[model samples]
Structures are given as C-alpha cells and as structure tokens.
Target: MPKVRVHNMTISLDGFSAGENQRIDAPFGDGVGWGDELHAWFVEASRDAAAGKTGTDVDYYVRGDENIGATIMGRNMFGPQRGPWQDESWKGWWGENPPYHHDVFVLTHHPRPKLEMDGGTTFHFTDDTPERVLERAFEAADGKDVRIGGGAAVVQQYLRAGLIDELHLVIAPLLIGRGERLLDNVAEGVEGYRVAEMVSSSSVTHVMLVRR
Candidate 1:
C-alpha cells in the first residue's frame, strides 16, 4: 500500500502556515516571518541525520524511509502564482537542482510540458484532479509511499478527500496572525487524528499524525 504523507509542514502559533502577501521574493513570508524557524529545522535535521547524529528526528523521518518513491505538490508549492499561469518560465525557486531527486508530479489547472532538472528530478504538471495525481504518483512510487507537498489548500483538498494517511507538522514559535492557516476549514469533515509521535526541539515542535 502507498501511504500519503506530508512531511515537515511548518505552522505558526496562530495557525498560519505562511505570512501575508506571499511573493516570489518572500516565499515563506518576509524576513524570518514564518518559515524561517522551520527552514532552520530542516537544515539542522539534515545535518544531524546525515552525520549519523541523533538530535532531531526530522531528518530521520524525512529521509529514514528511502521507500518514498514519488511526490505530488500544488502549483503554488511549485511556484508563486495566483490565478492562471501564463508562462512556464518559472522553473521553481530551487534553481537547477531541487531537493527532490526523484519523480515529482505537480497539480495545476493549467498544463505545461514536463520539466527535467539536474539530478533524477522531473516535474510533471497535471490538470487532472487530486485522485488522478495520486494514482500517477502511486504508480511512480512503485509500491512505496507517496509524499504530498503542499501550499496548504492542496493539502486540505487531499485531506478532505480522505487520501492522506499521515501528516507531520512542525510548529514554529512565531505567529503570523493573518496569513493562510493550514487547518482553516479542513478539520470540519475530518473525523479525527491521533498523535503518533511528538518531539520538542529548541526551534520547533515536530508532531506526527495518523488518521483515525
């Protein structure tokens, strides 16, 4: 079975995922607004895990399972764009090499040619619904788990559709106050979730959830 998971999603104390006026220049809000703390967490986690140190479990959680064979993300998560996308020049912020060196499927209303970057990473834009994306991702996953990279709304769509099996959220100490909240209208229909694990670090609190 292919498990759908959201790893290292950063949220604020006020429930905002990102600060207001999310732009290309300020992907995770201005300054060190919301995602700064989370970004640091990623760096540290990567370092420790790669070094075989047991500090934060995030690095282990994200890379522990090499079984994660495929990824599906929203358009916004791929790039910063509102309404319809007019051009395909925006190859994402990760530059020539993206972190995901595997197959990645992007969910979008508008379709664009598949993009292959350095490493084994390939971004395929899909106009189909979340189900279709998941299907394709599962095929690509090769019986491994499929990760759902989000920009909030996309996660909600899959969650409400009861497609997500696990969610790993990293709560930062800061507060956005008025940006896009991750759980805005999402939990309304969700029966509930259970905390599989929780870890407290100096910068953020990592919580793992499994659907009940």
Candidate 2:
C-alpha cells in the first residue's frame, strides 16, 4: 500500500510554519526566520544544486519511491501571492522549470488552466473538495504514495480529515511570532500519532510520525 506522506516541512518553535506577510521577496517571513537552524537545512537541501548537481532533495525524496505516484499542493505552494487569480502570467517562482516531475494536483478555490513547465511538471487546479482532490491524485499515482506539499492550510485539512499516513517535519529554531501556524485551532479529538524516528543534522532536526 502506498502511503500519503508529508516531508521536509519546517515549523517554528512556536509551531508557526511561516511568518505573516509572505511575499516573493520574503517567502518565509522577515528577519532571522527560523534563525541558523533553518538556514542550515536550506543550505543542505540545495547543497547538490550548490555543488552543481542536477538533482535535489525534492528529487531524492520522490525518486524510486515506488509507492509515490503523485503530489498534492496548495495554490500558494505552487506560486506567490494570494486572493483570486488576477492573471495567468505568474508561471511560478521556480525559474523556467520546476522540481516536481510527476503529476501534481493543486487545491484552489478559483479555476485556472493547467500549466506544463519544463522537466515534466504539470499543475492541475481542482475546485473539488480536498478528499476529491486526494482521490484524483491517488488514482493518478497508480497505487503510489501522494505527497502533500503544503502551505499549512492544505496540510491542516488533511490532518483534520485523518487522511495522512506519515508526518515528516523539520523543526527550525526560529520563531515567526505571527503568521500561519501549521496546527492552529486544530479540532479536538484528532487522531494521535507516534514519533517513529528522528534525525538531527547540522541544519535541521527531522521528525517522522506515523498514525498510532
């Protein structure tokens, strides 16, 4: 059985995933966001690219995972800015190409045409509910896992629905104080998960959790 996994997500000591007023210039928030802890993780994740390698952590995480067939992300995670779709010119923040090579489903209130970028990445916007989007993504994945590449809200939906199988988080050592918190106002009686493993690198502390 393929697992629905969430990985490489960063959180503040206070549980804020990202700071408020996030923009193209300041995606993660202003100031020493997450401090040195997050900088190290970012450096390592992009180390291969920094070393001039063709692959990145994104590739390594998805590659060879026979159970991984598709990805689901929020509209915000797909690009910058918020609110209704003003135009279609905003291709994405990633240069001419993006890292996602597989089929990706995006959750959005507004509908937009699918975007096909270089390197085999395609974004499909869905007006359907989260469960419907998950179903579609899983079907497209062909029995493989579906990664929830989130911008907090999307992850929260899945978490609330108990549709997630694994939770992988990287705890950064900084505090946003304000901004969107990952589990803010979480509904009560939510399922409890057990920490399965943990790894601390010079950059970040990676924690893995499995539904208990």
Candidate 3:
C-alpha cells in the first residue's frame, strides 16, 4: 500500500518548524537569526551528499525523497503569499525546475488554474480537505508513496484526521523561540503513533514516528 509520509521536517529545540514573518527573501521566516539555521543540517548534508558523503543527516535527507511519487503542501510551504491570488507570477521558490518532479497538490482556500511548470511538475491548488487531497495524491502517485510537504498546520490537519502513516522529523539543535510548531496539536490520536526509530548525528537528531 502507498503510505502517506512526512520526511525531513526540521524543528528547533523550542519546537518551531519555521519562524515568523516569512517572505520571499527570508525563506524560513525570521527568529533570532536561527530562521535559516533550523535547516542547516539538511542543507549541509545535502552538500555533503553531493560530495560523496554519507552519514545520519545525509541518509535522512536522501530518504525524504525516496519513493515519493506525489506531494501535498500548504500555501506557506509553496510561498509566503497570503489571502487570494493578486499575483499569478510567483512560480515558487524553487526556480524554473522544482525539486518535486511529480504531481504536487497545494492546499489553498483560493482557486487558481493548475500550474504546469518545468521538470515535469504540475501544481494543483485546491481548498479540499486533507482526505480529499490525499485521495487525489494517491491516484497521482501511481503506486508510490505520498509525502506531506508541510509548514506545521497542514501536517496537524492530516495528523488530526489520522491520515499520515509515517512522519520523519529532523530535530535541529537550534532554537527559534517562536514560529510554527510541527506537533502543536492533534492530540486525539497521539497514542496511535509511536517513535519507530531515532538516530542522532552531531548536528541533529532524526526521529521517525509511525501510526499503529
């Protein structure tokens, strides 16, 4: 079965996934200079991986993209834009060719025409519920797993609905002190999930949780 998974979601010691005041210039938002620092592990690991380095961070970073045939993300993850579409020119922060080369479903309240970008990526924006989006994602996945590319609230919705089968998080050593918290709520089904694995590197700790 194709599972719904969240991968390489990095949070701070204060449980912030992203900082406040997110903008095009400041990608991860702003919080005591640690906004960009939160993802340093993954970034460094990615560079290292490119240079033929394999470690806990690099392994987790690589694992995030493995078997991911489709993705569902919130508008925040797509960009810092808010409240309807005044500008349709924002293609995303990933430049012409996005990293996700599969069907990408973006959850949004406003309706917009499906964006077909380079590198085989097509963005479908919708106001549908998590379950509804997941259904379409599964269909687009073509037997591969679906990944929730989140910005906290989106992840919480799926978790509250018990839609995600597995979640892999990278807890960085930095502290944001404020911003988005990945596991803020969704307490109803907390007992249904368990920490299946944990590995620690010098820069961060990789934690994997799976629904029972």
Candidate 4:
C-alpha cells in the first residue's frame, strides 16, 4: 500500500510553519522571507544532492523526492497570488523547471487550467477536500506514494483527518514570533503515531513519525 507522507517540512522553534503577511514579494511571509533560515538545511542538502554528494542527512532529505508520484499542496505553497487568478501569466514561483518532477495537486478555491511545466511537473488546481484530493493523488501515483508538500494549513487538514501515514518534520533553531503554526488546534493529533526516528544536525532536528 502506498503511504501518504509529509516529508522535510521545516517549522520554527515557536511552532510557526510560516511567517505572517504572505504576499507575492514575500512567499514565506514578512518575517521569514521564503524560510531562508528555516529551510537552509534542506536547501544545502538539495544542493549537495545536485552535486552528486551523498550522506546520511543529505540522503534523508533528498530521498523524499524519490518514488513520489504525486503531491498535494495548498494554494499558498504554490504561490502568493490569491483570489480568482488575477493574471494567467503567473505560472509559479519556480521558473521554467520546478523541483517537483511529478503531478502536483494544488488546493484552491478558484479553478484554473492544468499547467504543464518543464521537468515533467504539472500543476492541477482543485477545490476538493483533502480526502478527495488524496484519492486523486493516489490514483495518479500508480502504486507510488503520495506526498503532502504543504504550507501548514493543508498538512493540518490532512493530519486532523488521520490521512497521513508518515510525517518527517525538520525543526529549525530559529523562532518566528507570529505566523501560521503547524500543530495548532489539533490536540492529540498524533495519538496513534509515534516517533520512529530522530536525528539532529547542527542547524536542524529531523523527527520522523510513523503510524502504529
């Protein structure tokens, strides 16, 4: 059975997944600015992966992209542009080639046409619930796993619905005073899940949770 997993999601010490006032200029919000500090480790790992380097932490971070046939993310994760597709020219934050080389199902209130980009990445906008989207993603996956590539709110919805089978969170050292927290309003959400592994590097702590 294919698992629904959330991998390499970086969060602040204060539990905020993203800083406040997210806009086109600042994607990760006003304070964080695309999560430079929070996502620095994974960025470095990705660079190392691109450079053909392999280590325990780097492999762990980079391996999330493997065997992931489809991904589900919120509109915020896709870009800062909100409301009814102001301009069709805005493809995404990533230029021609996005990191995701598979199908990406974006949760949005407004409908948009399917966008096909370079590197085999295609974005599909939907207004369906998490379960419905997961069903679609699973069908698209074709036996590969479904990844929840989130911007916090989408992950929270899946977490609350008990849909996630594995979660790998990278806790950064810094703190965002105010923003959207990942674990907010979902008390005991990990009741059946337990910490399967915990590894710490200089900048971040990786915690992997698996359902029992």
Best model per lDDT: 4
TM-score winner, 1 or 4: 4
Residue-by-residue lDDT tens digits, candidate 1, 1-212: 67998887878777777777778777776554332564667777777676777766556355534678899988888988866777678888789899788889998888889999998889998889899889999998889999988878888988888888988888878766777888877775367678888888777888888988
| Candidate 4 deviant stretches above 4 angstroms | none
Identify the runs in model 2 with alpha carbons over 4 angstroms from their true place.
Answer: 32-39, 48-67
Model 2, residue 59: distance off in Å is: 12
Mind giving the per-residue lDDT tens digits that candidate 3 earns over 1-212? 99999998888888888788777767677752422577778779889888988988888888899999999999988877899888999888788889999999999998699999899999999998889999999999999999999978899999998888999988888777877788888788567899999988998889999987
Clashing residue pairs for model 2: 34-174, 67-144, 67-145
How badly does each model clash, as a count of residue pairs?
0, 3, 0, 0
- Worst 10-residue stretch by lDDT in candidate 1? 30-39
Please identify which of the two predictions, 1 or 4, would achieve the higher lDDT against the true structure.
4
TM-score for predicted model 1 compared with the true structure: 0.90
Relative to the unseen true structure, what is the C-alpha lDDT of residue 144 in candidate 1, on a scale of 0 to 100?
A: 91
lDDT values of the candidates? 0.80, 0.74, 0.87, 0.88
List of clashing residue pairs for candidate 3: none
What local lDDT score does residue 180 receive in model 3, on the 0 to 100 scale?
Answer: 72
- Model 4: per-residue Cα lDDT over 1-212, one tens digit each: 99999998889988988888888887888778653898888888888888999875687888688789999999988887878988878888889899888899999999799999999999999998879999999999999999999989998888888899999988899989998999886666768789998988777888998998
Q: Residue 1 of model 4: what lDDT?
A: 94
* lDDT score of residue 63 within candidate 1: 51
